[model samples]
Target: MSFSITLVIIIITALISWRAFQDNDLKYKMMFYPYNVKHHKEGYRFLSYMVVHADLMHLFFNMFVLYNFGQVMEYMLDFKYGSSLGTFHYLILYIAGGLFATLWPMSKNADNPNYLSLGASGAVSSVFFAYILWNPGATLNLIILPFWDIPAWLLGIAYLAYEYFMAKKGTSNIGHDAHFGGAVFGILYVLLINFEKGQAFISYIFN
Candidate 1:
């Protein structure tokens, strides 16, 4: 059997990101520098940024989460809708989430030539939340803090809240806007694909 789409994505991203770490020019080309979009018109940076990460840990964390959530979501999609459409939809949801998330930062930071953001956090968040849409009761425990078992929906709410607050503060270097945008885009994608699933999600929590 062919390797799953999730694994393929992870492998490609890892290889490029590792090389990007060593090549300054590659990293500069991959980074989402608003200056490039605003003036020089290097719009490809929007999607290229997703494949390059800041460091080993950053790549590992994002790819690990993508592996966990993306595999399951793709499996569900393939099972529910047939193989071809499933793979295509999975591809769309991921790349679209990343592509869609880029617009906001580009528009907001068009004038700030110094502003640069790079990482797959936004795309990873989309995959993470897409899985949550199906299994809201799912819970996660950080490896370092196994005692803290948090429900997915609660964590999702907390995540959005934190991102929103941080985006407003604009103090941290973190791309909270991208995080939030990816998350919302994921949820919306799931809803668009299957509205009944969302209704069930709402009913599952409240009832």
Candidate 2:
């Protein structure tokens, strides 16, 4: 149903992101740095980085996506997994999703002291993919492109493809690589844990 946990996360992230906007030192402290995690023992950045965003736009976009998809995923999980386990697992899905999303980058760029990243894009991507998996036919109207009510599955494929294209160009500041990885985790995590339910969803979507 209308879940509380996702709202709670939005509130916390908003507060942190807002405060970080006013304080550059705080922003730097909360940002994820692979080098710092390995050498300086700043492991907590894995979680902290999700709360502190680069700007209001970044925070708004992420929380907006999470609000739409996370609530759906939560309600669906409640039906199959029960509310208690569903909420608990949702929390794990988010926090662990954020943590796990960083592993690939950390491993690849651990030596680069200047490399830093932040925001909830990784975990939010996971939630978005989960919603896409559970409801392929449902449509989403992007705020910027409200006229195009694209099906979630097509949107997902395009989203990943766009991320891959952007990652190759390296022109945008967005972490497209993490977004891609997080999306993969989102789809796999749900199917891996609930293969029968996933199968049911797939069957319903196609038939």
Candidate 3:
């Protein structure tokens, strides 16, 4: 059987998040603290923050989304680029997505020592948005409105708009900037690798 990178990432993230839940100091160190990154040279937090979470729900939601969308993305990439190169791109999409997601927050909060964020939502968003590109016609149901099946492309648009609005509002503790950034990165990364997919996605939306 071929190894599953998506499963491996979930397991690793779950274990680390579970342990961090029991250790405050560990979570603190793993969190993305922009000021610390700027002043204390703790650049590792860009990636480390993804292994920790604010709570069980946060971890579960991120991992659950990743598990579903990531598997599809993995298969699609492997089919298009072969297993080895595909796996490399998947890792780049995920890790770089997480790193890119923090760019806005890092720039905005670099001077504020109290700013801290943690979770894999950014990376997971990358996976989810990439899946949407491949399956724009797929139906998506929100947890709050389970009965209303939304088209994947529509959901992606709504998700991005909400994140942008919330990020601009800057009133919530949630990392809206990361979600927005990761999603955009996901779309662009897939388009960059497979320009034809972007054309197909546009056609799917219009016709």
Off by over 4 Å in 1: none
lDDT (C-alpha, whole model) for all candidates: 0.88, 0.85, 0.92
Full ranking by TM-score: 3, 1, 2
TM-score of every model? Answer: 0.96, 0.91, 0.97
Predicted structure 1: clash tally: 0
Candidate 2 displacement at residue 65 in angstroms: 0.9
lDDT of 1 at 128: 84
In candidate 1 the C-alpha lDDT for residue 137 amounts to 84
Lowest lDDT 10-residue stretch of candidate 1? 99-108
List clash counts for every candidate, in order: 0, 0, 0
The 10 consecutive residues of candidate 3 with the worst lDDT sum are: 1-10
Q: List the residue pairs that clash in candidate 3.
A: none
Instruction: Give the clashing residue pairs of candidate 1, or none.
Output: none
Question: Residues 1-207, candidate 3, lDDT per residue (tens digit)?
Answer: 188899999999999999999999999999999999999999999999999998999998999899888988998889888999999999999999999899999999999988899999888998889999978789988899989998999989999999999999999999999999999889989899988889999998888
Writing each residue's lDDT as its tens digit, candidate 1 over 1-207 gives: 155999999999999999999998899889988887879999898899999998999999999899988998999889888889899889988998897777778778998988898988998888788888878888888788889988888889899999989987889998898898899889999999988889988998998
By lDDT, the best candidate is 3
lDDT of 1 at 166: 94
